[model samples]
Target: MASNHHRLSGAPVAAAVDSAAVRITGLTRSFGNRQVLDDINLTIARGEFTALLGRSGSGKSTLLRAVAGLDHGTVGSGEILVPERVSLVFQDSRLLPWLKILDNVVLGLPGKDARGRGRAALDEVSLAKRESAWPHELSGGEQQRAALARSLVSEPELLLADEPFGSLDALTRIRMHRLLRRLYETHRPAVLLVTHDVDEAVILADRVLVLDDGDFVQDLRIDLPAERDPGDPGFQHYRTTLLGALGVLPAHRTKEQS
Candidate 1:
């Protein structure tokens, strides 16, 4: 895949020591009189896994689109500075049905090395044998795996995910979480995952942020061990905190407890 066309100055620069992967200041997005994102400011450090949570229409996806440069026409004020190379994964696999899975993975990639890299990415997702298969032939989980491989094949500096696994079944989602964690360990791309599931956010992200009323309501660090259990006190505390920020009572935790 080609590098993202959206850079602050359209010029490459070296990443400063411990520099942030994404930085937004005074960012705003409006549609007529309705402002979806209001002067949001955030910084995501290199290689950090951050999860964004919010109620519907709270501007989570809007913010991500702005960061991805897909909403440039709607973006107003502020600035979004991202690394030169970037990639995005969406809720849907979004693969072309007519293209073979391998061809889809190598879509925009150039040069003789493209095929090699694409196959390697597929192998990483445990789909090496399915490269010749069609998109319609794969299960939801498999399609998602292919989507992930396609995004990672480019080796981006930052990876933006908009609820990448939200469409999967419960068991498949769990497996994808593990797969994502392993992939992050190996690739170390700065990631921003926009998700609705508070538990999923807490389980997968190094930091969890809640966006509400067009601004950040909560920014909490996960400080738990990598191997986490949802039943653990620390994990539950973070989950409760995020769920509360969204103004919803946790189904597993009572109102008073939350």
Candidate 2:
């Protein structure tokens, strides 16, 4: 990891004074004549959990790419200052087929302690025994758990997830949610999750933001306690509000209206 630190030396300095893990101002991205993202400005504070909700082709992924610094040549203009240490998890595990689970976690990690740290991270996610297993051998949820270990092994200051649980079954997604919350409590990394699931956002995030036509349309704060009950009137209100922002109406709300 000592050598890895040198590679991260060039990353933009995070604005710790303002408690911002990520800060973007007047950001824009275009593909030829088509503007995919337009003049977007947002800030994510340290240790804050925020979720982004948007329709398909609404520039949610584009914005996430910009913040991850993966939009280097594609970005037309603007400043995206992200924390020096950032880790991203995608809907797919994206684990290498050839590498063992342990190796996958320590992929970019350097220094002598990398393996130890990798094992510890797997243990954190309750996958210590599967360290030697192949990616194809594990179940989908287990594969995602390994991916989580890989992301957290780096102990990043900011974590960016792009619909990570979208591919899982409902029950598996629920389990992942609990695991994520536990990990957040332990590590406290600033998190920005890009998701289309209104219920998931309401259940997990401290703040939920809606993006429509390349711009932020709504910003809502979830003030409920750690143990949230979807049946709670407050949860229903948030769910209804967010669904409405996404141009959706929950089944219950529709039934009530009828």
Which predicted model would earn the best lDDT?
Answer: 1
Error of 2 at 63 (Å): 0.3
Which lDDT tens digits does candidate 2 get at residues 1-258?
A: 011111112245334335677777788888888887788888888899999999998888888887887765563777766766789999999999999999999998988999999999999999999999999999999999999999998889899999999999999999999899899889999999999898899888999999987788788888899777889998998888888777786445522210
lDDT of each: 0.85, 0.84
Looking at model 1, residue 177 earns an lDDT score of: 94
lDDT of 1 by residue, 1-258 (tens): 122223323333444433778878788777789888788889888899999999988988888888887764453666677877789999999999999999999999988999999999999999999999999999999999999999999888899999999889999999999999889989999999999999999889999888988899788888987767999988898878777778786544523231
Candidate 1: C-alpha lDDT? 0.85
lDDT measured at residue 178 in model 2 versus the true structure, 0 to 100: 89
Residue 113 error for model 2, in Å? Answer: 1.7
The per-prediction tally of clashing pairs is 0, 2
Q: Which stretches of candidate 2 lie over 4 Å from their true place?
A: 1-17, 250-258
Model 2: residue 59 alpha-carbon error in angstroms: 0.7
Pairs with backbone N, CA or C atoms under 3 Å apart (clashes), candidate 2 = 1-110, 1-111
The alpha-carbon lDDT assigned to residue 37 of candidate 2 equals 77
